[model samples]
Target: MQFQIENIPIQEVKLDFAKDVRLFVKREDLIHPFVSGNKFRKLTYNLAEANKEKQDTLLTFGGAYSNHIAAVAAAGKLHGFKTIGIIRGEELVRKVDSNPTLCFAVENGMQLKFVTRENYRKKTSEEFLTQLTEEFGRFYTVPEGGTNDLAVKGCAEIITENEKDFDTICCAVGTGGTISGICNGAYSHQQILGFPALKGDFLQKEISQYTSKENWQLMNDYHFGGYGKVSEELVTFINQFKQQTGIPLDPIYTGKMLFGIIDLIKNGHFAKQNRILAIHTGGLQGIEGMNQKLQRKGQKTII
Candidate 1:
């Protein structure tokens, strides 16, 4: 399966609180209808590898609203490959209404295999891998959030496409896929700071599982409330950012990463840095529910 890597332009803006901190966003959110951001970069090589091996099926893992799953499903279907989604959590297929992400996956011919939280843990185990291999027949496995060596290699290519000399590159760290790929490309010169969305003390180990970077960092302060959760401050800031810059940030991922970057600039994190390029790994639809929730509380959507 072949996928296109869209060259999203660099969007530069000045930081609100930090006078010296100049901010830029690589608008991966504008990459595609589905295969946006780091998702496209992460999947590019994997899709090529699958095509080289003549594999007909692409199998991957994610939650019901997983951006990774959304990307893989759309890419696979668009390129004439079968897609399988090993989704986390129990089967809510019949009980709960599917969200836009899940609906997109289904519309794109992605077969859903609902797994319990416990079994989902063993998804990468030898036993489960064997089962999927047997069932899918020489299927290509893309890990959750598309974080693998192949994905990282493809992500590294992003650096060459853009001609900028930022001292720091910041992006939300989810499964470390995008950040790892970025670090692989950016670690030699630029400082790579990953604002993680996952909780638990094991996040650093988890991040290192994907990339090898000496100058990389993971911020522990800005998770807000783990993956898929947000605070009122974040919701407010997201609203303000859109109003000021006309950019919509989903709270689960990019929104919080931006919040951390702003806080860092305010706290003197970018004092001596020349520039910071923040990767906008798109998750716009994820904010639909948040928009509704905030609207119920009388908060308006700026975008």
Candidate 2:
């Protein structure tokens, strides 16, 4: 299987506060429809390795609305590899039709295997993997969020000579593969700022395992509540940002990251005349599912 990626475009975000501190966004989200953003980057090498090993089946893990699961499914279909998703929450098995992400994965020919939260936690355990191997036969296993050495290598390519002039590089932190790759590819003078979608100090250690660079720092205050969590303020910001910038940000990752970046800019966090490049890692597929939850709660939805 072969894949081709183009040079992603970096568009300037014109805001009032951005006058002194210029803000730009690397539109990694435009890489592909389903296999877009960092997902495309993370899977580029993993799929190559799977092809190298002559593996016909790919198995990975994720939750109901995981971007990784959707990307893997689409990629497998495009590349002619059978895909299997070990989905968290066995209860979601019956709700697949209502969930946009899972539905999309299934439409792309991915076989879904739903497990309880407890079993899902053991997904990386040797015994559990042994059980999966026994049930599904041999397969190339991609970790949750598709973070691995090869994934990091692919993400490192997100930065090129075109981005060398930026003072600070920014991206949302999930499994840390994307940021780690950015850190490795960044110039010595550029600072990498990671806005984690999930709240935890463990990401510092998780990211450190991939890159030894000291140019990156985590902004832990923008998580809203936690992973898969969003608020009215964040929703409003995402909607207004789209109206102002003509770019849509997923509430799970990009929305929070941009929100925090803009907030920082307003509070004079960045130095005057600083050029900031924020990566738009795509998770737009999860918007439908998130809107479903927001509507159920009688809250504002992403527009």
Question: Which prediction has the highest TM-score against the true structure?
Answer: 2
**lDDT (tens digit, per residue) of candidate 2 on 1-303:** 333366777899988746688999999888888898999999999999999999999999999999999999999999999999999998998899999999999999999999999999999999999999999999999999999999999999999999989999999999999999999999999999999999879999999999999999999999999999999999999999999989999999999999999999999899988999999999899999999999999999999
**How high is each candidate's TM-score?**
0.90, 0.98
Scanning candidate 2 in windows of ten residues, the lowest lDDT window is: 1-10
lDDT of each: 0.80, 0.94
C-alpha RMSD (angstroms) for model 2 = 1.3
Superposed model 1: Cα runs more than 4 Å off = 1-7, 161-163, 289-303
Model 1 agreement with the true structure over 18-59: per-residue lDDT tens digits:
666689988878878678778888888899999999999999
Error of 2 at 154 (Å): 0.5
